[model samples]
Target: MVNKAWRIIPRPLLETVLNNHAQHHRVPQPLILHGPRGVGKTTLILERLLGEWNKGPHLTGYIDFAESIEDHHPQFNKSFPWASWSNCPPPALSSCRSKLEHTLESMVEKGVKLGTISSHQIFTTLNKWHGLNTALRRVIQSNNAASKSAVVGKASPSVLWDRAVFALSARCNAQEIDGVLGLSEKWKGLSIEEASYFREAFLALRLAKEVITVQHGWRANAIAHLNRTGGFSRSLAHSCTDWPCLLLELLSQAAEIDHFQPKLVINNIDVLRNATLNDDSSVSASMYHDSLIWRMIALGANERCLPIILVTSDSYYSYQAYLDFGFTDIFISREMFGWTPQEAKMHMVTDYFSPSEWTVIAEVLGPIPRHLFELYALKQSDYYQKVMGDKGSTFEDIVDAYLAYLQITVVNPAMDNALELLKKFAVDARNGKISKDKLRFGAPWRHPPKTDDPTQCMEWAKLQLMDFVQCLVNTEFGDWEETLHSFFALFILLRLAVVGMIS
Candidate 1:
C-alpha cells in the first residue's frame, strides 16, 4: 500500500473553490466533486481539504461509502471481487444499504461534537435532558472511578449511541415503562419545542444504535449463507428514514449554539447506485429509493444551513442526480479529470526522478496520478532495477516492466467470462463484425439492450472484469478515441487475444 500522499498532485485552484464555499457566512449550495474513478477524488477530499478544515473552527464529518461496504467484507477489496469472479452472492450489500442513513446520522453527530466536548459530556447532558437515568448515576460514578485513564478513550458516535441505548433500555425495563415517550412528564421546566427536540433526538439516536449493533449479525448471516448454501442472501431488514431529519435538526441547533461552521463530506455516493443494481426490483424503482435520499439531504442542507460536500467518481452521475434530484439548482459541481500533460510533467519533476526519467514515465502513464505514483515505489525496489539493468534506456525498460506488471495485476485478474468476452470481441474484429474504425475509435462495449426483465438487468450489472474495465473507462480512455493512442490499451489487447489467456 503506497502512501496516497505521494500520489497527490496539489490543485490549489480547486482548493480555493472549496474554501470559498466553506468560508461563506450563509450556507452555499451543496458542493459536488465529480470525476471518473482513480482520479484522486477521495485523496483530495480526505487529505487536502478535510485535514485543513478540521484544524479550524469548522467541524467536519467524513465518510467513504465504498470503504464502509468493503469494511464489512474484507474478502472484497474495492474491486468488488464477488461481482467479478464468484458465483456466490455479494455479501453485506443489504447490510451496507440498511445502515446508510444511520451512518450519516453518526457522521452528523461527529460534526456536532467536534473539538467542542467529549461524547461522555454530551451523553451526560442528553441524559439529564431526557430525565430517565437516575438508576445509572451510581453505575456511572463507579465506572468513572474504576477507569480514570480509560475515560479519555472510545468516545465515538457509535460508542455513544451504544451506551445511551443500553442505559435507556435498562431503566425502561426495570420500571416497566415505555422508552423515551414515557419520560414526557419529566419535561417539567422545558418549553414545548425544547422537550420535543430532546425526545426526537433521543429516539433517533436509539434507532441508530440498533442499526449499528445489528451490523455484525448481518455479516454473520452473510458468511453462514455463503458457507452452507454457496450463495449470497440480501434478506437483511432496512431501518426507518425519519431518524435522519431528527439527527440533522439536532446537529444544526448544536452548531448554532457553538457558533462553528459545520461541513459534511461524503465520498463515493455512487456505491448507493451500485448496491441498488443488485436489487430484484425494476431499475426505476431501485433508483427511486436513492432519489428520495437525495431529496431528503438536499432539503436538509438548506433548512439546516449545513454545508455539504459530495465526492463521486460516478461518470454517469448516477443517472444525472443533478436533474432528477434538482441538484442543478442547488449544487456546485467540480470535475477532476486528472491533470493535463504539461501539468503532469511539472508535477513529476521532484527528488524521485530526473528530468528525462520523469518525463518518459509521465508520457507512458499519461496524466493518471495513481500509475505515476506507483512508478516511485517501483523505482525504489532493488529487484525491479536489477531486472531492468542494462537492457535498454531506463525509460524503455521501466515502461515495459510497468506494462508487464499491469498484465499480471490488472488484465490477468479478469474473470474467465470477461476474458471470453474480450476474445470474442477480438475475433469479431478479425472477422469484420467490429470494423477497424470502430476498434480504433475505442467505442463503448455494446451491452445487451435493457428490457423489463430483472434477470437480464442482473446479468448486465455483474462487471466481469471488476476494476479492469473501470480503470480504463475511468482513467485512461474516458473517450475511446484515446484508446488507439494509448499504448497501454493496445498492449493489453494484444496480450489478451492469445488463447492461453482464456484457458
Candidate 2:
C-alpha cells in the first residue's frame, strides 16, 4: 500500500476499476470520488486513471472548471500511448457530404452491373459504405434525387449520414472537433469506420453541454444547439446523470450506446450547511437535496457499471447522510489518512517553524503534540516577558507565571461551576479520613464500575504521606523533618476548615 497519510493512494482502487472495466468490456458510465480538500481526492483519481491508461488502450480526460468562466466545461483528451496510437477526425460537413456523393456513385456503378435493386438494400448498403469526401457527396446527391417525389422521402443511409455528420460538425465548430480528434499531419492511418465512431462519440460530447447550461445560462445558445443536434451523448451525459431529470435523459442516450460510466465523489459535506444561498434563498433550501442528487447519481452510476467513491470529512453532515442512504461501505477519513502523535507533532513543527527552532520549541512545549502545546508555550513566554521582564526566566518563575496566568486569564466566571465542584471535592477529601463515597463526588461514573480507581483520594495528601514516610526511612531531620512538621500542622487545620490555615 502507498503511504496514505502523506498522499492519497490509488493503485488498489485502480486495479479494481480496470478489472471491472475489462470484465464488462466497457468503461463505467459514472464514478464518484469525494473527500476533504487537502485529503487528495483529485490526486487519487488522476493517478489511478493514468495507471490504467498506461497499461492498455484507453482515453482519459480531465476538466477542472473550478476556477473557469464556465462552471463545468471539462478538459477531455486521450491518455498517453493510445494518445500516440492513432489520429482521426469525424466527418466534417463539407468532407462528409462529399464522401457520401462518391460512395453513392460507386454503389450506383456496382448496382448497374449487379442488377439487384431493393429499397432496404440501398439503405443498408449505403449505411455500410465507407468512403472519403468524394464518395459521401455522390451518396447524398443520389439520395436527394431518389427522394424528390415522396411525401417524406424514405430515410436513406446517405441522407441520415449527411444530416447527422453535418449537424454534429456545425454545432461543435472546427476548433472544438480539432481539439477532440487531436488532428495532426501524422494522423492519416485511421480508417473511415473509425472516423464514423468518432463522429458519434463527438455528438455525445455536444449533448453534455446541457448540464453546464442549466447551472449557468450564459452558455444557453451553445447548449441548446448541442441538445437539438443530439451531440451531447457520450461521457458528458454518463458523468452528469445526477443532474436534473431532463438533462439526465439527454445524457443517458450516450451511456446506452457507448457504455461510458461516470463517477462522483463528495467530500467536506459538513461545509454544505455553510454553502452560500442567493437572495432568493433557493440554494439553501436545495443544498441538501442537491447533495442527495450528487450521491444518487453516484449510486446510480455505480449500479449501472460505473465505479464511484465518495470521500468525506469526519463530520456528522456526511456521516449521517451516507448512513441514512445506506452507503455504509463509503470510506471515511480514518481509512484514508492516519497519523501517529509523533508524526502529527513533526508535521506541525515543520509547518510552523524551522528545524533549528525545533529543539527550543520542544523544550518549551514538552513532549505533547504541537496543536495543544505550541500556543500554550508561546502565550506563556509572551506574558513572562511583558509582566516580569524576564525573558530568561527560571523554571520556578515560569511555573508561577503559568499558574497566575491561568487564574487571571484562562479561568473565567463561566468556569465557576466546574471550579466549585472541584473545590467541593477538595474540601470534603481534606476532612478526617475522607471516605470512598466523598472521594467519588463530582466524578463521572460509567457502566461496569472501575475496580481499581486511580483518582480515589486527594493527590496532595498522598504526596505528603510519601514525604513523611521518606523522613522516617532516611532519619533525616533538617529539611525533611521540617516538611513533615509543616504537613502535619496543615493537615490538622484542614480537618477543622480553619480559614487562614488550609486556605
Candidate 3:
C-alpha cells in the first residue's frame, strides 16, 4: 500500500487568491487564513512562491519571530544549511552593506528634505551607494592613474563614485552605470551640493540594479538581538522595521526603473511573528501590534501603485477594517476548504489504522486526528492485557482497567474535588421535585426524557448516571462537577415523579 501520509491536498481557495495576486498584482486585503494546527498555511505559501509567482518582480520574505537568531553562536559552522544568516554568499553581504552605507551617505548629503523622501527612495539611495562603492573599489584597483594610497585618502567623491561605475562596467562588460545614473550623470560638473545630490541619485540607481539580481526571492531578513541582561527595547523593534521598509522601497524602485508598477506578494507573516516573539517575552505585546504597522506598509505600497499581497494566519479583523486598510480582496478559511468532524473521523479511520482496530480505537480516542486516536487505541489494548489478562475480554474487565488507569493517572490527584462536586450535584437533584419542567430544566442533566411512561424516567436517569461516571474515570474535577450537576437534576425529577405517583 502506498504511504498516503505524504499526499498533497490542493487548497483551491488559496490557489485562487495566489493566482489573482500573480495575474493582477493586486494586494489581497484582510485575507485571514485560519484553521486548526497542522492545516498547512505555511505549505500553501511555499507552493505559491514556487509555482505562479516565481517570475514576478516580487520579493518574498519569511520571518519566524518565535526563533531566536541571536542564540546561534558565531563560531557555529556558518555553512550549515539551516544556519540562519550563513546561507547567503559573502558578495551578497558586501553588496548589502555597501548599498546601506551609500544610501545613508546620499541621504545625508542631498539633505533632500527628509520628510519628502518616500521610503522607496531611501531604499534605492542606499542600494545604489553600495553598488557605487563596489564599482569605485574595482575601478580604483584597476586604474594606473590612481595609486592605492591616493585613492583611499585624496580621491574626490565624484572620482570615487565614477570608479564604481567603471568597476561595474568591467565586471558585467555592459554600460549598466548609465542606466542607473540617469540624469545624475549630467550634473557631474555642478556645485558641491548639486554634485552630491546627483551622486546620491546615481548610488540609488546602482543599488536598485543589484537588488533585482542579488536578493533571494521571498525571504524575510529579521535582525534580532538580545540585551546582555535579557530584554528587548523599543530600539529593537525600530531596527527590525528598517529592513522591511528598505525591501518595500526596493519594490517601489523597481517600478521606477521599469516604468511599470511592480506587484508585491507578502506571505508567511506568521514566520516573522514566530521569529520576533520567540523566547524573548518582553516583545510579545508588540508582536500583535506589529500587524497594524504591516497594514500601514501595505497601504503605503498600494498608494504608490505597487500591488501588495499580504497573507496572514490571524482572523481577528473585520472585513471593514481590511477594506479600510486598502485590501482589494479577502480569502478566509470557511470560505475556502476545511475538514468537518465527520470527515475528520472518516479520514482518520480509513487512512490511519486497520479496520479491525478502528472500532476499539474510536471508542477510546473519539473522533479526532489519527495520531491522537492511535495513542489512546494503543493504550487501551496494551494496558488492559498487561493489567487484567486473566480476567478475559469482558465489558466489566475493560471498565475496571479503564477506571484503574483513570484513578492512577487522571483523576487520582483531583478525586477528592470530583467526589465533593458529584455529591453536591446529587443533593441539588434531590431538592428539586419531578415536574416535567423541572426534569427538563434542572441542573446539568444529560438523560433523554420519557414522554409517555414516567416509570422509564428512572432507567433513563440511571443510564445518564452511568455515562457521567464513565466520563469521570479519567477526567478533571471541573468536568466531574459539571457532569454530576446534570445527573443530580435528573435524579431529583425522578424522585418527585415517584412521590406524585404514590399520592
Candidate 4:
C-alpha cells in the first residue's frame, strides 16, 4: 500500500487524550482511550506513535490483538511481518517482544536515543542459546539512502555490541527468585542456560538494522552470526527488562512537558482481553482472568507514576471485563465522539479536502471523521476517480457516487437489511411523511398478529414491543413526546391511506 500523509484534524477529544496524563507528568494508571469502532481511535494514537515518533520521548509497547496485522498501522515494509501478533498471549515474553520489536524498529528510525542509566539487569551466570534473525544482508540493502544519512554520528556497531552485553549482564529482569516470594524456581528459567554470545549476536542484528536504516553500506562481521533460530525472540524477551528502565531514565531526564514526560503508549490492547493461555478451553475469558495489563498496572505503571496511554476500540472495550478485574482506578476513561459542527467545518478548510463535498458529507454521515476518511479514500480510488473527474459536480452527484462506493466497498450481510430499510425511507420521503422535523430512519414494522382477546403470549409480546420502542425512542431520537407523537400520527395516516386505496 502507498503511504498517505497523516493529517490528524484535532478535536476536543484528541486534545484531552494528548494532555490528560501529560499534565500530571506521572501516569497513576493507564489512560483508557475508549470510543466506538471505526471512529479513528487507532489513527489518532498511531499519529502520535509513528508520525511524532521522535517528538515525544516515549517507548511504546504496541500490541495489536487482531491475530494478523492489517494495513491500518504505518508500514515498515517486509522486515515487519514477524512483528505482527504471534500465537503467544501478552504475558508471554515472546508476545510482548513482538510489540517491543515495533518499538525497536521505531527507535532505529529515529536513531536509538538513550538517557543516563540508573538501573541495570544483572545475571550471576549466563548460558548459550541459538536465537537470532537471519536475512539481514538483504534487508540492509533495501533501505533508502536518506535513512542511512540520518545516523551520521550514532553509535558504532562495536559500541552497540558492548551495550548489548551490559543489558544481558543486568539479567534483563527475567522473573528471578531470591527465594523470598517463592519465585526462586520461576526466576531460574531466565537465568540458566542463556545464549553465551546472545547479547553480542542480538546487537549485531540491531546494528545491522541501524546500518540498513541509517548507515547504508557500513557492514559488520557480527551480521554473519545472525541466524533464524529462536534467536530473535530469545534476545528480545531479554529487552523487556531494559525498556522500563530505559524509559524511566529517558522520561526523567527529558525536558518537562506539562512539567512531565510520558514514558509509554500501549495500542490495540484487545489481545490482553482476548488471547488464550496454554490449552485452556476458554480463550478470552481465561486471559481476562489474569491480565498482563492489570499486572503492569499494579507494578511499574502505578508505582513509577509515569504518564501512559492505552488505546482500544469500543467494540472490544468489554465493560464486563472492567468490572471483573476491578480496574476502576487503573485507567481514566476518555470516550471519543464525532466531530462537532465547527470542527467539521474547520477540517474542511484544509488543502486536501473540498468544502462543497464535505458540507454534504457532514449532513449525510453526521460529521464522523472516519466516514470522511473512507469517503476520501473511495473518491481517490481508480474505480471512483473517473466518476469524480468526469461526472457532474452537484450534491446529488456526489451523494450518488457515495452510494455506489458504499454498495461495493463494504459489502456485508448486514447491509442487506440496512438497504431494505433505506428503500422504505426513500418511499416515505417521496410521500412527504418525513421532513426535517421528523426524520424517521426506518419505518415501524407493519404487521401485527390478529387477536380479539389478549392471550398470555400476546401480553408478553406487547410488553416486549413497548420495551424495544422505549429503548429506540430514548437513544435514537431524544424527544420522547414529539418522537412518539410524530410516529403515531404517521402510522394513522398510513392506515387511513391503505383503507382508502382498498375502497
Best by TM-score: 1
The regions of model 1 sitting more than 4 angstroms off are 1-8, 24-28, 69-91, 97-239, 276-292, 297-305, 326-330, 390-393, 411-503
lDDT of 1 at 434: 57
Q: Global lDDT of each model?
A: 0.50, 0.34, 0.40, 0.42
Cα lDDT tens digits for candidate 3, 1-503: 11244334455666776555445433333235443222444456565444444343332333322122334322343211111121112122222223333443343222222112332365434544333344344445654345466566656445565555444444542234334434345646566675445444444444334443233211122222343344544444433343444544444434432223344434423333333333332233343246334533554545442444444433323243346434544332233333444555566555654454456644553332323332435344656456546645543455455446544643333333333333444344455533445345443445244243434554554555456555545463224355454454223322211111111
Query: Model 3 RMSD to the real structure?
Result: 17.7
Candidate 2 segments exceeding 4 Å error: 1-166, 170-172, 207-305, 327-338, 345-503
Q: Give, for candidate 3, the lowest lDDT window spanning 10 residues.
A: 79-88
Assess candidate 1 and give its lDDT: 0.50
Indicate whether candidate 1 or candidate 2 has the larger TM-score: 1
Candidate 1 lands at a TM-score of: 0.55
Q: Give the TM-score of candidate 4.
A: 0.48
Cα RMSD (angstroms) for every candidate in the order listed: 13.2, 22.0, 17.7, 18.3
lDDT of 1 by residue, 145-232 (tens): 5433443454644454445445444443423222324444555756767544444344435543444344333345444444355442
Better of 2 and 3 by TM-score: 3
Tens digits of per-residue lDDT, candidate 4, 189-224, equal 544333223332333334333422322122222222
Q: How does candidate 2 score on lDDT?
A: 0.34
